[model samples]
Target: MSDFTQRFLFDDFDARGELVTLEGSYRHVLAKHPYPEPVAQLLGELLGAAALLIGTVKFDGLLVLQARSTGAVPLLMVECSSAGELRGIARYHAEQIGDAQSLGELMPNGDLAITIDPANGQRYQGIVALDGANLADCLSTYFATSEQLPTRFWLFADGQRACGLLLQQLPVDRQKDPEARAASWEHVVTLADTLTAEELLSLDSETLLYRLYHEEAVRLFEPRALQFRCSCSRERSARALVSLGREDADQLLAEQGGTVVIDCQFCNQRYPFDAADIAQLFAGGGVEPASDTRH
Candidate 1:
């Protein structure tokens, strides 16, 4: 499949891994706005990492990867849901972002945030300083420090598509001996380190797996499909308007020249409401406002 995530288990290494290859979803996010190459690639890698992170957890809500800075790029965010919906956006200053390639350069003094908001449980978040050379290094450090797990991530993106592969050493393993388990982990991680961005981005999932670990026994699970689906709707935007109450809504409406407009940053979809529509929405009988507008 073109856009999917696959989970696998290592028979001998006692470790598990995840691979995600994104095309349609990545292109759809890019189509929403004009992004420079560095910003676009950064968003893609975040999308890949978000997808892999979703697969690693058992949650019914959303997982977000975000980095905000006062430097060149103000905001870089990507999110994926339990149902495999993916969306991302990046806001950057073109003049300040010239020729800067590293994450540190793109976002100085930035904080990388991984947020897990579950539908029925309390939300959890991990924050780290974005001082690494690349996004992958930052994520690897995050996992090492936070989860205390030996997780290695390989993320890549071209203007066309984005891809990511994650190799994690499962906490509980078949190898009982400590030294042998460490050795196994090292062997698998060492082989995984040989993976290049080209091979990870171009090759198919099974082909790439075989090429990387043809000698090892690996079990590939069913792939989960992912798509670019925006959660914005007229109804939801109307509820937001409801919260503004009548007076504020009227003032905002006047400022907006008649209709109140709310734009979805992820998909750039517009939801507009006029006077009558706002009155109906506040009257407890919601009315159809207007069709969505995309720029």
Candidate 2:
């Protein structure tokens, strides 16, 4: 009812659109870290984009949006699961964050990667230069350069709530005439481009869609609910300890006062690995049968 993604079809044209709004989930991700205003807003945009991806891409597993850079913001990542779970994080250099406004300014020379890890199929990845004026334009550039669909994204976030609208041109379907398809696509995107960030962040899916495409034939589909859920768990943490090998695990356990704490950066959930737990993990016991402890 609150955090949701909806897909709509332009009944008269060969195009479709995705709408996503986030409030509770966005706040949850923001609460996990002391992210600066810019970083938080950027992360919110990524989260919105990730949810929109879920609506547009028919995948059964996980989809990740990552932008890596060596500038003020070293990393910005968002994960969306088919089951409607979402999580995101951002790492930034404190000294350089105050003046950076745009994505390029915050993460100069960054590469945006879209990774699809299906539950049963091969993983797919697409990388593009993050050089557009905004996140939406950046994604629009990616879709345009990749020769996929003619897709344009309108992403907005104010560190409190995040929302986005994505309009993509599909292959010749209902509107068989190439010229008609082009005209329809142009009309839809032009109307969408008239949208403001405030309107996007404030309006509901139905109102916004009507405001933009009221004259066009559009069918709004039922929205899929989304929530903030970290994939980290005690078992996953134990596996990380096992990867360190016995000697290193033991050394870490000693360094952390007999308990090696592995914190989930996305959610700040802590997993403590004591000596016995580490021993059992390294002894091939599998996850070390014990109660879970997290903060």
lDDT of 2 by residue, 1-295 (tens): 8899999998889999999999999999998889889999999999999999887788799999999998999999999999999999999999998778888889888989999999999999999888888788888989998889899999999989999999999888798888888888999999999999999999988899889988988999998899999999998888888888888888888888988889899998877777777777877877755435432
Q: Tell me the lDDT of candidate 2.
A: 0.89
Task: Give the top-scoring candidate (lDDT).
Answer: 2
- C-alpha TM-score for every candidate: 0.96, 0.95
- lDDT scores of the candidates, listed in order: 0.89, 0.89
Clashing pairs counted in every model: 0, 0
Clash list (residue pairs), candidate 2: none
Off by over 4 Å in 1: 290-295
Q: Which run of 10 residues does model 1 get worst, by summed lDDT?
A: 286-295
